[model samples]
Target chain A: MDIIVPIKQVPETSNVKMDPETGTMIRDGVGTVVNPLDLYAIETALRLKEAHGGIVTALTMGPSPAVKALREAIAMGCDEAVFISDRSFGGADSWATSYTIAQAIKQAGRYDLIICGERATDGDTGQVGPGIAAWLDLPLATYVASVTTLPGADAPVGLSVERLVEEGYQILELPLPALLTVVKEIGSPRLPTLRGKKRAKVTEIPLFNAQNLELDPAFIGLKGSPTKVVKVATPKVMRSGTVVRAHDEAEIALAVDRLLAFLDERGLLPRGDRP
Target chain B: MSFVWTLAEQHGGRLKDVSFELLSRGRALADKLDTKLASVVIGDGVSPEQLEALIRRGADEVYAIMDPRLAHFVCETYSNILSHLVKTYQPTIILAAATSMGRTVMPHVAVRVHTGLTADCTELDIEPGTGNLLQTRPAIGGNIMATIKTPQHRPQMATVRPKSSRPLPEDATRVGKVIEVPLIESLIDERVRVTGYRTDTADFVNLEEADVVIAGGRGMKKAEHFGMLHDIAGVFGGVVGASRDAIDRGWLGYSHQIGLSGKTISPRLILTAGISGSIQFLAGIKTSETIVSINTDPDAGLHKVADFGIVGDLFEVLPELQRRLHEHAAAPPAATTATADDERPDERQREERV
Candidate 1:
């Protein structure tokens, strides 16, 4: 099996906070890291390669700084890396991003499976994986929690996986050359080894641009994206109620009493307690 | 003629609540645009009453596509049917609840029809002059809200978060049309097959339907501390919920999680302890009727949004609250008035010792 895992570099969302006074994002000191979730996808690919014997390739689409993400993936044990970067790909939505990545995947030759993180932290859409599957006309599964079965020399040429749904879990079977978007339940990601880090530092990562991929100018970037962000603003703060400083035991009792009174006023206390 | 369409979602032969919620919102949009509001449902055993219910909940028309193959959700087959309908009818806007099924299928349909799709929109509106569907959603982990538009795409699509809005009350006297559309054979794709489904017994608490939710977060420190939350919930006949932080730490199952990536809940009253309230967690509980937060940090974000904020150690506060609640539940009906006074001296003594 030849596996390809698509990864992204994203700002540490936990560190991205809103400036209380200005109501603007405080991105000054926040640094970019390989989207934490994508680490699971890379680990899944590496584990599959170790078990079934295949080459695991890390693929990414972003500005040149994204090469750092690919190197990190290599350090986590990916066999090779493919980087797709260009000025034209800026401002792309999920649709256009998936289109360009699909084109890149096509140019990277053959692959039996593609894996992606369930969603990116910044976009939080979980659309790109399915969008890419649509662009490539490949069977796709999202929120896969576990890979129950994989095709091997003795097994059939299909894959079975467990998908995490709202109600429960669904066991699904799909043919080879399918795409899966994985959740955290898949497995805990592993740290990089010294040898793997050494290999990653010197590995040559080939780059694919729109010109080389022969992507149509009309379907590559901002011009090609159908959805446009017309306006962005800080979410309105809805509540500015009382904040009690309960430093002493007396204050704690008073705070608890206030909560009970509030609940009582709303008739939200337990039925027996409602007067 | 162009119309506003809502893809009604169903499971086990019943329409989901979000389906009606979409129609409730779509009804307003359709009226603003001076167009019809239609609902499309694809399932195996949809009854006539279910179709009529859609109409009573504000759908001008309900399109039913019944097939045994659609008894289970397959994105390829469902998107093919929807893409075909979009191409044939050319609706002006399409709305779906951002549930697992909606999120899975809408993207494929949008791609097939060459349109734009906004996911998990908290607000939807019709632009005043141009009549575009305005999609407002949280981005960058809910640090910012962005309003999006699809100027060139027909059947402009967006998925609204479930529980963000309430469904309009059903009007039994109202009447509308029900059109049963035949499922085309070619639309069915057999590439992926769902073999089985297993309910997670560990997540038996129906957090979404709980009238009262008591949640804990990282400040709880360890999984064992969640027991206090559970005890408090038991006193109120409620369920225990957890923030993403607690869930990520394996302190609670995902089903009890309240956040952007987990379940959105709108309980009548929610009491959270130790939770700093990340925006993602706020998104899930913003629709809650009332919020009370207890945290050690005075500046925790949750305090900004909570109706009642207590700056105290959850470790001490939770145990005290739990004991008080149990006492309240056990107190005689006549003694309820004196319960506060009865506990005041004991609480003060305990605090002074600390």
Candidate 2:
């Protein structure tokens, strides 16, 4: 089984800023990072391959710098890396984003399983993993906190997962060739090995774009995308913090007393157990 | 009218409350667009009786996919079928409740059809000129609300959280057209097979849907001390929640964690104990209609956001409040009826990323 993991190169969210005049994300000096969540995804694939003995191929779609993201996946233990980037692919939304990735996955041939982050931090959409699974017709489980292998690959890889459910945790198991979007419980994820880092430095990543992937122009970019962002602006901030201006301990004592009574009257205090 | 397609969400072959809420939302969008409402039903278990019920609920046309294979929510299968239906029908808008199933299926379907999908939307409106969805959702925590639009796309899609939108009273006998979609074996794969499924066994409050939430923070100091919040929540028929500090300190599980790194909840009444109310914690429950805070510090940060503030030890206040609540058994219940519990996942906080 060949496991393919997809990583995205996103601007470090901390560096994101809006050009107040133009209403766009100011992307200057915003260094790119291998989506931190995808690192867990890459590690999950590598671990699965380690035990199951399958080849792991990491794929990405972005600018030339994106090759580094895939290489990082390689350094983390993936056997191969592929990058898909072109001018035509700019400004694509999640839908078009998944299309680009899916078409690339198809071009790369077969795989038994695909892994990706639960959601990209920059977008926070959490849609792409399931989206790719849909385009590729695979099962998906999201917000997975932990993953434990079950017996039997002939069936779906037995996957024991702990999901953050309605105010609690729900554990479920499913078979392999499935798509999984994980949260923090996949085991701190294996760190990048020195040997693995050395191999990644020398590895050359193959690039594929819309043309090389042989996808129709209409299905490759903004024109093919169903949704487009009309505008982006720095939201007006509201709710200024309040200032307490009393000077002496007497004044402070009086304020505290008043505040306590107010809370009690509102029954803000904890309640007794129900029958 | 620009169209909004609402799923009449059903669980275990039964319709969910969010389905009705979506219908009401869809109805408003339909009226705004000067078009009719389109509702879809999927699953073989939906009987003709159920079909009749959906029409009465306000759908102008209902798309039904009744197949044994489509019974369970296999993500790829649902996406394939829904994407096919949407592409063929071509509604200008689409919506689903942000239930476990909706979140999973909507994103995948949106991608398959090559459209953008917004998640956990709090508000929706129709753009007058283009009839696109003006979908507003919380961003970077609830400190900001971003109203986004997929102006260039058809069938603008999003999933709103349940209870986030109130249900339009269901018209039990209301009626619409029902279109049955043929099944294609090619659309599904058994790449995933289910083994064991364990039901959530903890008997704690469900913070997301609780109208009255009493949350404990790290100041409570231990796992057992969380019981104080639980006692209060029980009296009010509410759920117990925890601040990220409590979870990080191991006083609570990740499931009970609430903040930008946990679940976001806006309850009617929120009573916090020993919490400092960091921006992240406030991000989750700032929408509460009324908030009461208790802390040892006379000037904790929570005092500002909370509608009411108390400067005292929670250990003393909590037990007294619990005793008082029980003493007031003759009093009326604080919140409305319990919210439907059909949702699956807890939440995704902006700060909780790997």
Q: Top TM-score: which candidate number?
A: 1
Residue-level lDDT tens digits of model 1 in B54-168: 9988999998999988988888888889999999989999999787788888887888888999998888999999999999987776667878899998989998877567677
Candidate 2, number of clashes? 14
Reference-based lDDT, each prediction: 0.83, 0.69
Interface RMSD values for all candidates = 3.7, 5.7
Worst 10 residues of 1 chain B by lDDT: B342-351
Residue A255 of candidate 2: its Cα lDDT?
A: 45
